[model samples]
Target: MNLTTKILLPLIWLLCAIPAGLVQAQQAGQTKDNPSYAALADLLENEQSREKLINELRTMADETATQAETVAEEASAASSSSRELAQTTRAIAEGIGEQFTALAEVVNGLVDGQVASDEQFSLAGLMEATLNLSLVIVATLLVFMLMRRLIGPLLYARLDNWALHGAGNTPVIRRVICVALAAAVDVVIVGLAYVGGNLVATFLVGESGEQTTQASLFLNAFMVIELLKAGLRMLFSRRYDGLRLLPINASEAAYWNRHMALLIGLLGYGVMVAEPLISIHISAALSQGINTLLMLAAFMYAAIIILKNRRRLAGIIRTKAEQSPMATSKISLHLLARTWHVLALGYFAVVLVLVLLSPANALPFVLFATLKTLGIIVVGLLLSTLLGQTIGRRIQLSPELRRKMPLLEARLNSYVPNALRFLRFLVLAAVILLSFNAWHVLDLATWYASEAGGVLMGRIIAVAIVLAVAAAIWVTCASLIEHKLNPETGTGIPSARTQTLLSLFRSALAVLLVTMTVMIALAELGINIGPLIAGAGVLGLAIGFGAQKLVQDVITGIFIQIENAMNTGDVVTLGGITGTAEKLSIRSVGIRDLNGTYHIIPFSSVDTVSNYMRDFAYHVGEYRVSYRENIDDAIAHLQNAFEELAADEAQKPYVLEALEVAGVVALADSSVNIRVRIKTVPGMQWAVGRAYNRLVKMHFEQAGIEIPYPQSTVHFEGSRQGVAPALKLEQAGERYSG
Candidate 1:
């Protein structure tokens, strides 16, 4: 605007413009305060916040996409790995299938006789086998001939001498020696044959093929088996002239010998043939079939023999049962016989099944197991019988044992059979363990080595040893105590008190020993004996509380016994009861009064005890004499009576000291009192007193010394007017009548 006027005009224009600018500014301020404009500003701010939130969401989405891609890549890699692993597993399976197929083909070929053709049926093999067989037969014949020519004659001579010299009267030892000599001869012959056979077989099949090795084995087995059979036949011959080991009838011996030989031969043949077939790698199916037939035939033969002899077996079992010492043992024998019969049948059935179902390779093991079981049983029976008989005989013959424990001897005689049965059980357990080991059924050693089993076994062994030791100690102590307590002619008899104390002590010792044993056993068994001991302590405390009176009585009685205060047969006054102590126990004293009433007084209740018969007792007698009699004479008479009692042969031992008369102990109105005292041995006071009193009465009567009852004189004051008193009484009676 212009400066002056223009200033005015400019002022106006400026005022107008200022007004307009103020109006616009105020309107703008108002619009800002308006609800719609404020809402728009808030909407803008919200849009900006939403835009920021959208940007963050887009970043998160991108990151999530990257993570998902990584996960997809991992899944794809895992899938590829799994596919590769599956393909590898499939390839391995296919390889295994091919190997199995090849093995099957080899087995099929072998079973089809392709592998064993050359070894089994070749001319060279046949010739070698025949040669070996011929050599074995010739060697056996030579050995038999040599035995017959040299050793057999000598053996027969000795046997014949034994039979002629003793026969039925022969001692067991001599018979056993003759039998042993015969067995030796047979063994020598068989041993020679077997050795020769082995030499021939080895020479013929030296380092040869499977067929040759089989032939060698067959030849040796056959020779040994045949020799054993022959030896058995010779030992068990039915002929009386022959050496027979067992005492059996001719018919029974013959039956057993024939059947046993046949059974042995059949079993040996099966074993020999089956073993070779398996060793030579013959066809499995063919070998199994042949073994099955052989086992079946052997079993059938055994069954036939057993069935035919079943009656005989039953009779034998019954005879043994009847002869058994224990009646209960008959049941056991019957059970054993039944079990044996069942086992025989079951074993045959099981073996037949095994031969049919199992491979040829298992046949030898089965047969060996069966034979081993049989051998163990026979050996066990023989050993048990020998040990039982020898030990039983020795026990029965022991004079000292019989004298010391007559009752025990009788019991032992009765229990000898049971002891043998226990031995048999032990043998059975051992055999069962051995059989399990052979079959590899259970690893006992490994099990025993484990923590729990080791501890358990140790506990068992320790408990057994401890129990045995404890029993020995108990028996020894009991025997000694019994010997001490016995009332023999020369030995001092045990008094009732001594006997009672000894009995109580023995019972207490037994209780302590049993308690200790139980605790030790529980500890060994892995039981927490600490708690048991604590419980015992608590229970003892409770008993002490509950039975305090009993405990007190026992303690008091013990002290009294230790102090020798009273004993049985002593005249004692306990509490207020006076009687003879009949019995003494730990808790109470039993007494019998003169009235025949028994009193069992607890020691706790006995506050004061007075034993009359300790080391010595006193017997006192009182005699009253008339005043007219001479005191000196009466005293002298009493002394004479006492002296007479002391000199008496029947009362001399009871009277320890001479009697003394104390003159004039008390004087009554009519008589003088005199006392005589005698010292006597214990438990004789009453007898001495009675005798002294009776003697005093007899002496007083003989000496004319009056021993009188109590007397008193009464003085009456009779006035000089005794007649006036009588008159007054008469007049008073008359006046009362009026």
Candidate 2:
């Protein structure tokens, strides 16, 4: 163990350990032998394997370096994206901070008057502007007050009379028109006031024709606010009750009008006058701040109004709804009663947010949106009302027309009521959606101006045209069928068979038209009808398999109809039930018997149909007479009875042929049966038979022809005791009448 030997041994150990550790750490990949690492020391013993191991090491090292580079590149890219996102966020935050700082700075400038007024204005510019605006307002008010005092009473009286005389579908409608006219009058007053104010601003205030900013602001505010006040008068109309539009009474209307006008005026004046005046002299920030405070105040006021009147107004509306004649109006009134406050609050809240977000143009936008919403609602209501008036609640055909076409009005009514409701619903939804668009809650305006909107509108129009055509075709076909069935149209009364076939045809035509219209409408709406049609066909096949009895009924009925076995209004015997066929359908027959019992018999249940009224019918009479009577005389009397029946106005038309007598039909135990037959029109045989029998009874009585009835003949030899028998006849269960 020399020093040189120890140093060499330690250095060799270190070299061997370093290589093993390097291979294990660097090579994580596995091999076919389940080994991921192989030290150079282990491979050095095999000279041929050494080269392969070296190659494998070189390959693993290269792969490791490539993977690390890829991971580094990915991490670097991720870092770069994150950094960019952070920078963008920081920039947005900084921009917001700068905007806020600017707002604060501009707002602060007012405290020390640091903001520069225009060269045309001075240090006291805001005060002078306020004074000029106040004078113009006073002048406008003076003009309005003078004119109102002169004609207000007379105008109200005339308007009230006109409103009372106005014709409309509903009282609310007529009064609404009157109120609108009244509002127009108020607008005219405002127009006069605006003109006066304009003159004062131009001449008295020495402003040019263009008018200074403050003068213009004041003049515009006066006109807008006064016009709003006038419109409120329509709803209120405390003095002229006939001009009131709302359902509320005069007191409530006045109270609401006063409060709402105050709030509206405050908000309007603040936004139109104060803000603009401040912006002209102080700063835009101060103007915005004032507007924010004004809006908040108005909101608080509106909240108070809602809290005070929510329940009371709801009760009033509930009463009105109960009193309403129209079901739809009642439902709408009830809904509005419940949601009115929520809707009003939402409107104000939206406007507030908008004004705060963009103080420059938001106020004007909100104002215009309010006007647009009102106009849209008014127009929609008018259109729906006009439509309702045109269609009415039910189809009412003239008596003559109804007689000529019994089912035409019924068929029209079947579609009309539902279509009317659907149309009204569509109108209401459009109005609401348009209102939302006006409020900027939706982008309908933008969409309506786009290419897709044009295409959708075109498709909708095409669908409407298709539906219209379908409706016209259905009406024409139905009318023709109805006319054919009618006896009053100069055309002769149709046969029972023809009537039934035509009725069934009309129904089938209606079904086909409806189906085609629906498919075409769905296609126009961009729905694929192919799958729907296939599904329907499959469903029909399945139904046919599952409902064999129903199929049998339909098939049997169709064959029976084709053969003209029976028809509506025919006297027929079906399934042992003798009745008149009141209604005939594809799969069933509705029969009403003499006892007023109605039977609905499926065609499958009817194996036989014995139509008594097919063509001509026979009234066969078998009259029994005593053996002693002459058969020729009895037969002659029967012929006389038929002759009398033929002479009757009611029965004459029923007799088709003279009587055919068959004398001595049979010799009964006590009487002779003489049979006679007479032919009459189909369906009138029963009446003719009844009349003939009555005549025969009368004729037999006059001719002394003994009509022998069942009786027991008593003789004196009866008692069996060789005593005379006495018989007394008495009636049981009989009540004598005077």
**Candidate 1 residue-wise lDDT, 1-738, digit = tens:** 245753443333322212333455456665544433333333335655446545755886799999999999999997998898787667645644554555465467666646433355344655665565566557656766776679655667668578547655334445556666766766777667666656655564444333355555555666667666655654466655436545456677788888777777676655675545443544444443455457668888878777776666777877777776544447766776666666677777666555554435566777577656655654554454454454446345376654544445555455555556565567667666766765556677887989987988899889877776766666666655665566652266787567667776777778888988888888888889998888989999999999999899989989998888887778899979999888787899899998999999999998888999787899987789898999888888888887899889999999887766677898777777888889988889899899989998999999988878866685545578753322222464464321
- For candidate 2, lDDT tens digit of each residue in 1-738? 688965644454333324444465347553545232233344455566566656766886799999999999999998998898787667645644555676677656656657634433356666776677778878988999988877688786787887777665465567667778778878888888889888888888745665778888878887788877776676577777888765467788778888988988899888888888877777665565566678778988888888788888888889988976568778998999999889888888777666666667888898888888977886787667656665575779999888888888998888776677778878888998999888778998678789998889889889978987998798888888878877888569887788899989988887888998999999999999999999999999999999999999999999998899998999999999999999999999999999999999999999889999887999888999998889888888888888888888988888998898877889888889988888989988888889989999999999999999866775555656776655544569655442
lDDT of 1 at 451: 91
Model 2, position 58: C-alpha lDDT score: 82
**Best candidate, TM-score:** 2
lDDT of 2: 0.80
User: Per-residue error at 459 for model 1, in Å?
Assistant: 1.0
**Model 1, position 90: C-alpha lDDT score:** 75
Whole-model lDDT, model 1: 0.68
Model 2 TM-score (2 dp): 0.73
Off by over 4 Å in 1: 1-135, 138-188, 196-219, 222-257, 270-289, 307-331, 358-360, 375-443, 479-503, 568-583, 590-601, 621-638, 641-653, 662-675, 686-738
Give all TM-scores, in the order shown: 0.62, 0.73
Clashes of 2: 0
Please tell me which predicted candidate would have the highest lDDT against the true structure: 2
lDDT for residue 212 in candidate 1, whole number 0-100? 53
